[model samples]
Target: MLLQIKRLSSSYGRVRALNGVELNIEEGELVALVGANGAGKSTLMRAISGVQPTNGGGIWFDGADITKVSASKRVRLGISQVPEGRQVFSEMTVEDNLLLGAFTRPRLEIDEDIEKNYVLFPVLKERREQLAGTLSGGEQQMLAIGRALMARPKLMLLDEPSMGLSPLLVDQTFQTIQKLAESGMTIFLVEQNAYVALSIATRGYVMEGGRTVLEGTGQELLDDERVKKAYLGV
Candidate 1:
């Protein structure tokens, strides 16, 4: 497995946000976890990425136990997360924001990786010198994905990539995500839009009330009557 979590648990002060969740992703596969707000989807992402502390269980990446790794060190281990908000550096130029993603990489390899991002998001290339704050919401979301890619991660985590977008932009973003998956990127996506998310997923797990309630291939979940009524709005 490229990433694995077994019986993982986490908390926000006294309130438990995660409860013994188990998930896994193999190399070059796009796996998705779908749920509504406060379903612990983001918490699970944070725990795997090492931002949220794990109170129990284990996280292993590339066959090594990383349950106790520091957040900064986890980045070096090839996990990059594009958080829910398009948290671009509003004060910095687009290219500058992207450059930050490769901070741990050798200086010589930085430009080459950045050029790759430009190809992935041409709008960002055109706005390379523009302050990120000036871009529209959809543009900022693109920049955020580009910045995360600049790291050249082995595994990428996308949290609610389509949130708050117009239907058209959301469609465009998921298309880009599909392109990435087609290119063999290992992605773990957490999304509220179950129908769209599962449509792009190789496999999916349905999450509710801090635990995984169902798991299957994308098509299987989409075809399920329970899933349709609860999440797909059938």
Candidate 2:
């Protein structure tokens, strides 16, 4: 496994957000996590990235235990998260925001990473000098993904990359993700669009409240009676 979470639990003050959640991702696999709002999807992502405190359980990444690792250190260790809400630095130029993602790397490699982003998102190249705040929602999401990619992560945690976008943009975003997966990026995706998520994911898990209630291949979840009724609206 490229990443592993065993009995991971997280809480907000006194409110528990994750209840012994367990999941893993193999190298070159895109694993989707689908659930409703308040299902602890984001919490699980945060815990894996070490931003959220784990009340119990362990997280192992790339053969090392990282349950107690700092968030910045996790990034340096090749774990990158494109957080929900596409929280790009609104005041920074697109290029500047992107450069920040490679802050820990050698300065010589920064330009190369930026060029790779340009190849992935041509619009970013055109708007490289523009303030990040001016981009559309979909554009910002793309920028967020680009920023994370600048880290050249081995495992990427994507929290709701399709959260707020037009239908067409959502499709476009998903296509980009699919391409990323095809290229062997290990992606752990947290999404509310169960139908679309399960369609592209190699494997998937369904969450309810704070627990993982189901796990299977994408096609299996899409056809599952409970998942179809509660999530896919089948």
Candidate 3:
């Protein structure tokens, strides 16, 4: 396994958010976690990224235990997260914001990575000098993903990448995710859109009230009657 979460649990004071949640992802695969509001999907992602402290359990990445590592250290260890909100710096130029992603790397490599990101996101290239705040909602999301990619991660944790976008943009974003997976990126996706997520994912898990209630191949979950009634609305 490229990543492993063993009996993971987390809490916010008295509120228990995760209860012995277990999950695993292999290298070069796209795994989707789908759930409704307050399902603890985001909490799971934060725990793996080393931001939300785990009350118990272990997080192992690339054969090393990182259960107590800092968030910055996790990023350096090839784990990158594009947070729920596309938190790009509004005042900085698009290129500058991307440069921040590579702050852990040497100065010479940062410039090279910025050029690589532009190639990956052509729209960003055209507006490299423009402030990130001025971009459209979809464009900003792209920039956010690009910023994470700047770190050259082995595993990318995505939280609701399709949130607040038009249907067209949503399709585009999912397509980009598919392309990334095809190019050998390991992605652990947390999304509310069960239909779209399952379509692109190789395997998936369903979370409800801080617990994983279902796990199967993407097609199996899509075809499950319970999943259809609750999530797919079929």
Instruction: Work out the TM-score per prediction.
Output: 0.98, 0.98, 0.98
What is the alpha-carbon lDDT for the whole of candidate 1?
0.91
Candidate 1 per-residue lDDT over residues 1-234, each given as its tens digit:
998889888899998888889888999899999988899999998888788887888999999999999988988989999998888999999999999988778899999999998988999999999999999999999999988888889999999999999999999999999999999899999999999999989999999888888999999999999999988887
TM-score for model 1?
0.98
Give the runs in model 3 whose Cα sits over 4 Å from its true position: none
Question: What is the Å distance of residue 162 in model 2 from its true position?
Answer: 1.0
lDDT of each: 0.91, 0.93, 0.93
List model 2 lDDT by residue over 90-191, tens digit each: 999999999998987889999999999999999999999999999999999999999999999999889998888998999999999999999989999999
Per-residue accuracy of model 3 over 64-108 as CA lDDT, tens digit each: 999999999999999999989788998999989899989777788
Steric clash pairs (candidate 3): none
Residue 57 of model 1 has an lDDT of 88
